[model samples]
Structure formats: structure tokens, C-alpha cells
Target: MHRRIIAPGALAAASLLLAIPASAASYSPGAPGIGDPYYPYYGNGGYDVSHYDLRLKYQPTTDELRGTATILARTTQDLSSFDLDFLLDVSEVRVNGIRAAFAHSGQHELVVTPRTPLAKGTPLSVVVRYHGVPSAKTAYGFTTWHRTPDGAVAADEPEAAWWWFPSNDHPSDKATYDVSVAVPDGMQAISNGTLQSTSSRLGWTRYNWRQNKPQATYLATLALGRFDITTSTSEGGVPVVNAYSKNLGDNDGAARASVERTGEIVDWLSGYFGPYPFGSAGGYVPDTTTGYALETQTRVYYSPKQFANGSNTSVVVHELAHQWYGDDVSLKGWKDIWLNEGFARYAQWLWSEHEGEGTTQELADYVYASHPADDAFWTVKPGDPGPDNQFDIAVYDRGALAIQALRNEIGDKAFFTILKGWPEKHAYGNASVADFRRYAEQVSGKPLSALFDTWLFHTSKPAAPAARTASLAAASTTVAQPKSWRTIEATNDVHGH
Candidate 1:
């Protein structure tokens, strides 16, 4: 996520040469951070998913998932009818351990309703056994292989968690997860949290991962391949595990470096936010052709190429930050994606600060320069589209800038106080822009409504009054050299540090 900085002379020359007024960018209506238009009450009414014990037997030869999911859920409200969204690729289904009636609503979802309604808080357990290959579209970047062209087989993404299990898929409903993934011999299977046990049956090996802490569905991941795993511990004594494909060259050095650094970043972030939100922190570098990485709970998936030139560290920091912002405190809907991306993106600058690599102003200028001053910011209202369109730079970069603006308006002490207080105040929960705005206003004792509206929801970028910009410039001239000022260092050594 980090890019090499341009030389100082080149940056200065470019800054001077490009003094021309920049044009505004357009906007697009996209998905909300959490809720989908299709499922209005997706995460509503807490779900008790403990009744399900899933057994999945994936067949790589035909790219199919032959599995069984036992569901035990209690209703909180009287129901004439009830529905569950089970993301499946094939049509086979059963209920109450029998072949019950079901139908495919669309390419991405399956709808199932029990024959009769149960009373409020009624407990019911149904077993659904299905078989089919999971759709590639379900996965954002990673893939779960059914059958490799070379006869080898692997399953990644645990797409079946959504592809097979019927429950709320959003982060708002944090639930305990127990996953048992069976893979062929010679392949390693990994998932979130701790390794409860491993068992071998037939020709496949079943690796079980049980997470005692509550986790969102998307963060619950699974990967299977011929892996070389290296284990270590952080400075604070937290476990650090790295999983890499056997095909990759000596991963020992890379694994050690990445894990240690990941531990340090986690320690630093926990100091700012709160304790690490999950049970463990690690990275999973699978052998893939893509060039992206994902922050799936405690474990992050990275492409091998990102590690080639040591550019992977930034991605490591970016994803690890999600453990606090995205994973711990989720966005209410897609419209609040800035809640997820902006905070994670800011982690990069925080990383630079921790490394003593750049000044806060320099980082702010870098962000401001890259941000587009246009109506694009509000084009995508929250909860309009879906999750895919939510990953754009506007949500990530511009959103982070808005947070930085807030930090600037309210001194660092109050700003980080809000930041640290959020997850603690609403840990394992959902939050919206309004929730954040109110918290900031309460903490800083400032009427920030104008600022939030102008920066967050307004169509155009907020412009500083001519006088304010002039005053800031004059203030900057009188300040000490930018490089010597340690804003993050000073903030870090506080009580949280």
C-alpha cells in the first residue's frame, strides 16, 4: 500500500510546476458499507448460530462442494415466515436432516424457509447437505480451487461459509466460528483464531480452526495448499503465524521479518486503539497471479509478488489496522465505507510516523495532492450499491483525509482520544458517520457539524477560506523544520504507548 517517495528536489519541482487549478472529479452511486438493498434486515436481531456443525468435503475434480451444515437457531420474534440467505453455487439442499424444499433466488444466494413458524425465542435445528462448486464471483480476489489443471486441488476463501452456511454475512453480527476444512494430503489448511485440533480420515486431512472471539463472516477465512508454515511470537507475547505456498522460495526469512513487523504494528495499533481485537495476528501469502491483499480478521492474504521487493510491509500495516477499524468496529452500511477504508489507509501514514519516515504535514500534503476535488464524494450514498463498488480510492483515501481534517481541527490529544475510545465504546459492534461525528463533537467540545457535512457528505471538496489558508501558510513558515517534529512519536509515548 506504500509507494516509494519521490526525491525532494523532484517533488518540489513538480509541486511548483503543477500549480494550475485541478479539475473536479465525478461521482457514482455504489454499495453501502454493510447492508444490501436486497436484505434490509440482514444483521438485525442477534443470531445464535451455535447449532450448526458443518462438514465439508470438497471435490477438486469437478470444482464442487459436497457438504452438510447442521443449523440450530432460535427465533427472537414470532414468525409466519422466515428466510435465510445461504450463498451457494449449486441447488441441492435439505432441512431438518432431510431433503426439504428450497429454491435458488439468484446466482449469489439461496432462500430457505421452514415448513412452519416457531414461537419467539423458539429453537430449531436443521441440517442442510449440499454439493456444488463455489462461484468465483463470490470471492473478492482470492479463489478456492476445486480441481487444478495439473490434478492438484485446493480450496481457499472458505467461500462456503457464505456459499453453504445460512446466517448473517455482515460484520455487525459478530459470532463465534468453528471451521473444519478437509484437504488432500501434503496440503495445509489455515483459518482464523486458534487451531483446536487436526484429524486425518480417508485420503484427506481435516484442520480445525475455532475462534472463541466474535468475528464477522467475511473475516472468517480458509486456505488450503501445500504450505510451509513458520510460527513465532510478538514482543508482547502474542502468537504470530505465517503461511506460504511451498512453491515460494525460502519463506523463513520473509516469514520471520513479516511476522515480527506485523507484531510490532499490532502492538503499536493496540496501544492507540485498544487490545488486539482478535485472538491472533498473522499473514497468509498464497501462490496466486493477482496483485492484491485482503485483511481477513487476524490473518491477511497477500500475493507473493508484493513480497518480492519488500513492498508487502505496507499492505501488512494496512490490513492489520483493519483488525481495529474494519474488523472490530464495522461500518453500518456500504455508504460508510470510509469508516472501514479511511481508517485503514490512515494506518499507512501512522506507520510512516512510527518509522520516523515522514512529517504529518508532508503526509497530509501527499494525501491532499492525490485527493480529487469533485462531486464524486457523495455520488455514492451509503447503502445504495453493494460491497464491490465500495473499495474505490474515494472511500479509502478521501475518507481518511476527512479523519485527518478532524484531527487537525481538534488537537491530536482529543483526536486520538476519540479514536481510542471508539472501539472500546462500541467494540464488536457497528457504527455510522453520525455516531463518529457526535463522539468527536462531544470530545473536542466543538461544533463540528459544518466541518463533517462539508468534508464527508457535501458534493464538492471543502475549501478553506482564503484567509484561513493564508494564515496556515504563515504559521507553517514560523514552525520548526518538518522532519524534526515528531507528532506521532509524541502521541505514541502517551499513556496508550
Candidate 2:
């Protein structure tokens, strides 16, 4: 069933106006909850994810992947238990290591309900091993490859995490990960956090990575290939590492430059905003055609395109900022996605400020000039339809402008204080717009309700004539505001226009 039904209130009008019989549309099996679309469930109950050890037996005639995963999660609710949303290419499922029945809800999600009620916090482990050619159309976006120009296609981006593991399937649930990926003997695997160990058995190599800290499901990643490893240290003394293909061009020098610059950006951001909330920070520039980059915990996966010009600071800064906003203090749900992307975008602007590139007003002007004509900037409610819907320019550029407005209202000291205090107060957790608003009000010692309400929830941009005039007046006193004949002739520079 893959159809959406209208409400009862509209049924009468529809029946009266329509002459033809209306066929009942099938309900989408794996659709998310009514209120929270991305993450349907919520609570303090944590999840333990594992059981992804499987051998990949590839067939040249038919592109397919044969694999399995064991997922162990505990919840406080116990009403004969409920189902969790997972994205996978599964052939078989087993609960408590025994074959269990399961059903596919939609194109992306799977629902497996245990036969018996498990106690709250009691470990309930399920192993799902499947064999199929991974698809790029689904929510997980996991792509299985038979062969590529470089070698076997490595799962990359928001899709790769689903290639092997079954998780909460979104950024909401921050869980602990113990992942062991077994790849062909020649291929090396890279994932989040410090490398625990690697052991070669038979013709396969198993690489182990344990992320003890709380991490969102999307940040979890894995890459397989023969990689050339390079190591460095941050100014703040955090270990920086890079994993690029031995087949690609000279990546060590670019990786070193990227690592050094990344560390510098982290340090700069920490000084203004707080410590780097994550344990370590680095990049993994894989030799691939994918143009996008993901800020996956301490390790960011960058495509070869990002390193084409030696070091892409924009990409580096964007991902580095996520270490604080997205990875450290994530949004409570998809509704508040701006909380993650908006903050990161604003952090980029702050970086520009630190570099003495332009003033905040100039940046605001730039964003305002580039603002999309669609009223969707402030009107599109969260939890719309798909993940791509959440990545609109409004959430990134306009969202940053909204934050910049607040920063301008409150001085840099207070604004940065709020930024530092936000993740520090809510470390390893989730937050909403209301939570941020309250914190900003407390830190800035000003009533920011009107400000946030006008920018965030309102449909139109706020009139800033008074505010602009004040800014211009302040700039004239401290710095040069542009000299003009009309302003110079006036006794007082203040002009009413």
C-alpha cells in the first residue's frame, strides 16, 4: 500500500463535487509517525547496535551483496513491544539468533515485532542478514557495487551507513556503536572514531571501530578500499588522520593541509564557541565521483572533488562546524532541522568574520541579496516529506541570516556565550528551537522571543530600518561607514529616508 488518504472532514465535499467513483488509495506501509516524521519514537531509553559481521560473496552476472546484521536495542515501553524503522537489503531475519518472521513496510523501512513482550532495558538482539543488490532510490541510499573503475564501488554519503548496519535510521537517536566490518583481503575499511584493531583471517580483513561517545545514526559511516594512511596532530593536540586511496594521485600533501586547516578551524571555533565537543576530527577523501561530503563524527568523508584544489575550506568549514551543532547537540527531530544546518551555516559566517573578510552587515546583505523568491523560507513547516526537503537553501542561508540577526541584536560576547553554553548544557543530547531561544535569552539578558518569533516562525522578514539606522550610526562612530557628499553636507550624519 503506497497511498495517502484524505481526512473525513473533506470526504463530504469531495463526494459532492466528484462525479466519478474515487478509489481508495493504499496506505504507505513504512511511513513515519504523524507528528514526528523522521523519528517516530522518543524517550531517554538508549540503544545498543551491533551484529554486522558478514562475508560479501559477489556475483558478476547479478550485482548482489550477501550480508547480515545483529541489532540489539532496549526500550522502556513494553506493550507487547513495538517496531523500529530500519533500512537494509535483507534476505533473512532472526531474533535472539533464531530465524524470525519480518515484513517490509515500504521501499525503505522494515518492521520486526518480537513474539513476546520484553522487559524494559532488557537486551533484545535481532540479527538480519540479507542478500540483494543495494539500491540508491530508498531512504538509506546504500549502493552495492559489482565493480568500478577504481575497484568495487564503496558505499558513500548518507547511503553507506545502511550498507551494513540497521539503526534508528536518522540523526535523532544518538547511540553507541561497536562495528566490525569484514572486507576482502586487499581492501581496508574506515569508519568513525579511533581504530580499535585490525586482524586478518583467511582471505578477509576485519577492521574494528568503537565510538564510545553518543553519535547520530547518519554520522555512522564505513568505507572499504586499499587506503594510504597519513597521520598528524592538531594544535589542541587531537590526533588527525587521513585515509585516501593508494590508487589516487598524491593525497598525502592535500590531506595534511586539510588536517592542519581543519585543526586550526576547530581551535578557532572552540575559542569563540567552546571546546571541540567531539573526541577527534579528521577527513577521509575517497577517490570517487560523488560530489557531496558528510560530517560523520570525528571522520568526515570527502569525495576526490573536494580535494581537487588542494583544500576546499568551504567544505572543511561546513563539516567542522557540524562537530559542534549537528554531532554534539543535534536537533530533537526533523522539525527543528534548522537547529543543525542553520547553526553550521552561521558558524561559517563567523569564520568569515574572524578572517576579516567582511562585516556581519555585509554578510547579511549578501544573504539577503541571494534570498530565494519563494516564500518558503519562513513558511515551510518542518517534517515535510523527505530528507532532501529539509536541506533547502532557506534552512542553510536564510537560517544563518536569522541567527546573524540575533547575534547583531546581542553583542558577539553574548552570542558566542550562548553558542558555547548551548552544547555544553545539552551535550550528547537533543534540543529544539524553544530550548535555544530560552538559552539565548538567558545568556544575552534580553527578551529574544519577538526576535526569534519574527524570524523563525513568521512568513515575512522583519522590517529593519530602525535597526539598520542604528547599525550605521554605530559603524560611523567606531569604523568608517562610507563617505558621501550628502552625508558630509549634513550637520549630523543621521538622514531620515
Candidate 3:
């Protein structure tokens, strides 16, 4: 997710009728939520999803989406009833092939009462059938579904699965997915991971995509529209597939120029962040009014506006960096968003250095000097910016500044080791800011609590180290400005999500 700059401004249940378990005395209802303070109702407790098999059909004419979700999970506790985060009208629900009683209890919860009590540690299969126009369903007074001129795209941060499928809807519960969407034969349905097959019958075509790695529900996405798709292989042999809306107006070439570099960017990023963490890599641009681009798992979502000025590979670099930091090792909760945005924003600075635009220190010094100590930007702590300020510009720019400070304090060898090693240590799972701090200390063999407290936890500006202050002070007195200095800073203007 790319965060826009703020110039002192910013942005379950359970039930069962069937045979009761032999030890039915312990069976109880699952907690309605997973208990994240930021989003208490985001994911349900008592179950851990392992996979989601989604069979869907969409019609552009009516904007109707029909889907059947087969979920595979294990009961963490004996469940008499459980909840699946979802919206839309559910026509039928079955648990273990037995008809289950179901109803909508809250804004997005689909509560189910299975015929039989579910025992702890037992594998379970749940099939849910439903159809609705996603554009018409509103939650939190907004809809993540982007209705386009050709079709629709499902991509957003925090929550998107509720608009399409049913599952554990939080980053903490990562699961593999097999998403199959059938659209008109002339249209295309794009999603995460690699394309397995495409079959057409009558007037509809089914596009099957499989994601073998564990993924958060919000990262699972589907895009249906008329697209011009390109296929290639990266230098590292990673399969690359990119698509663009055929009617992208004047930004078609720029969009392609940026997105087509996915293969090259993935390879370049792998040198620092380790290997690309998914089976395939690519991105898509659909003609939608969404103001931000999203790092949706394997296939990132780019708004047409991202390329309005010209080809913008910086945004691509930010999103692909997420393929490792955000997508592979996700946040344990929303409060740790800096783990995703900070690392991504920092990657852009690294890219600028690689392109001979500016060094990371030069960029960091510029940002640190741009915002005054009295500015509100410094008041929003990146480590635990509350929900309302979660996407504020400070979370990105100031967050990256914190990272640069760490590098300075720990030296090059230990800092780079922590960067590559942190992801490898927590790959395909969720982690918190505290977890990252501990890991960094372990690798650097330094007491970093003071550093983290001053840079991340504190709501006040941190005093600049003498070396950093002298470098920026010297650079400021240079006869000529650094190459691409303005361009690197201008990237903050392009908003993302």
C-alpha cells in the first residue's frame, strides 16, 4: 500500500444439529471475533482456516457475483457454533455435507449452526452458496468493490474477502486459495498466484488460479474486465504475467511501461529481501476511480491514476517489496502496519539509490529535514498509530526514517542481515512490531529499546545524531542538487492502499 504525503495533513458462530460429540459437555459457541483492538470483528476465533476453494461467476451487465466457497479448517476449540466473515445474501450453507442453519448476525458475520458439534483439532469442510451485487453492499459506510466500465475488481486493505467469499478475514489467519471465476467469454478474470487453466462453455469462460502458499483473506482478489495480458519469465525464472485494461485512456503506455517491469523488479528486490515469496508475480491496471494502488498478494492492483504523469516504477517497487515483507510475512495485527509500509517505502529509497537518483541517506536526510519538529507529522507514532491515523503520511515517510536510523546505529552488516533475516525467520506468518524489534536486537547484538522508543514509540521528534546532521548540513551547501532528488520525494504524492 502506497501512502500519500500529508503536508501537515493526512488521510462467527457455530451450531450443530447432527450427532453430538461423545464429549459434548465442552462444546460452546466460538467468539464472534479474533479480538484485535483495531478491528475486533475482523476475524473470528475458535478456528484456523487452511484453504479456500472459491467457485464464482460474475456478470458485468448486472454486476451480480455468484459464488460457492468450500472452506477447509481445523477447530481450535470445541465449537457448537462459529462465524465466517461475509456479506451478500447466502442462499444455503452446509457443514460436513449436512445442511446447517445460518443467519446474518452483524454487519458482515454469517453465523452457522451445524447439525453436529465440532470437536477440537478436527478438520472441517464448509460450503457456502450465495450471490449478490457487491457494489450495493456497504460496510462502514463504504464499499471496497470497484465497479468499472467493463466489469469489477475486488481489492482493498484491511478487508475485501467479505465482499466476495467467506473465511477467516484477518492477516493472522493465512490460508492457501484456489479461486475460479467464470465471466463472459470475451472478458477476463484475474486473481492471485499462477493461472492453472481457462475453460469456456456456452458464453462464459472460467479462469482458474491457484495460490499454494498461505495468504490472508484480504490478499485474495478477483478482477474481471477486457484486458491485454502479457506473459514472461524473470531473470530468476519466476513466471511473470501482467494485464492492463484495454480502455485505460491516455495512460495505457505509461501503465504498461511500469507494470511490465515486474519481472525485473522482482529479481532486483530478491538480492536484498531474499527470494520472491510467491509462485508467480505480476500486476493489473483496471479502469476504476480508486485513488490508490493495492499490493494484492501476487497480482498487485494499480489504479489508472498511478501512471497519469508517466511511467512510475517506484510504485511498482514499493508493491513488489511487499510481496516479501507484507504478503509473505504479514502483520499480526493492524497496529504493526509500519512493518509493511515502512519496509516498502524504504525499498523505494533503495531503488532510487540503485538508479543513481540519490543515496538512501540523502533521501532520509531530506525527509527528516522537510518536516519540522513541531509539525503534527511527528506526533503520529508509526509503531502504533491508532486506527484513524494508521495510513497517515508519517507512517510511511517517518517510518522509513526510523529504519534508516536503525541502519546507522547498527552498521551496514548487521542492518542488512536483519532486513533479509527478519523475513526468512517469519516467512508465511504474522508478526508484531515487538517481534521485529526483538529480532533486530538479536541480529545486531545491541540494546535497541532506546532507539525504538525514540524513533517509533515516542510521539515526539527524535534528536538527530551528529553524523546524520552533519551529512545533511553539508549536502545542503552543495553547488548542485543530487540527481533525481526531487523525483524521489515526489513519489509520496501518489496515494496508495
- Candidate that would win on lDDT: 3
What would the per-residue lDDT of candidate 2 be over residues 153-178, giving only the tens digit for each residue?
Answer: 44332333444455555555577776
> Which wins on TM-score, candidate 2 or candidate 3?
3
lDDT of 3 by residue, 1-497 (tens): 31221111100222233234566767877777787777777788889999999999999999999999999999999888888988899999999899998878657778887888888997889999999999999876677888999999999878888999988898999999999999998999999999999999999999999999999988888999999999999999999989999999999999999999999999999999998888999999999887687889999999888888898899999889999988999999989999999999999999989998888887777777766678899899999988777778898988998899899888899999988888899989999999999999999999888888877888876665542532333233333445755554555644444
Model 1: residue 337 alpha-carbon error in angstroms = 1.2
Best-performing candidate as measured by TM-score: 3
Cα lDDT, all candidates:
0.58, 0.58, 0.85
lDDT of 1: 0.58
Q: List the candidate numbers ranked by lDDT, top first.
A: 3, 2, 1
Candidate 3: where are CA atoms >4 Å away?
Answer: 1-25, 465-497
Residue 412: error of model 2 in Å? 2.4
Instruction: Indicate the residue-level lDDT of 48 in model 3.
Output: 95
Per-candidate alpha-carbon RMSD to the true structure: 13.4, 9.9, 4.6
How many angstroms is residue 407 displaced in model 3 relative to the true structure, after the best TM-score fit? 0.5
How many angstroms is residue 201 displaced in model 1 relative to the true structure, after the best TM-score fit?
3.2
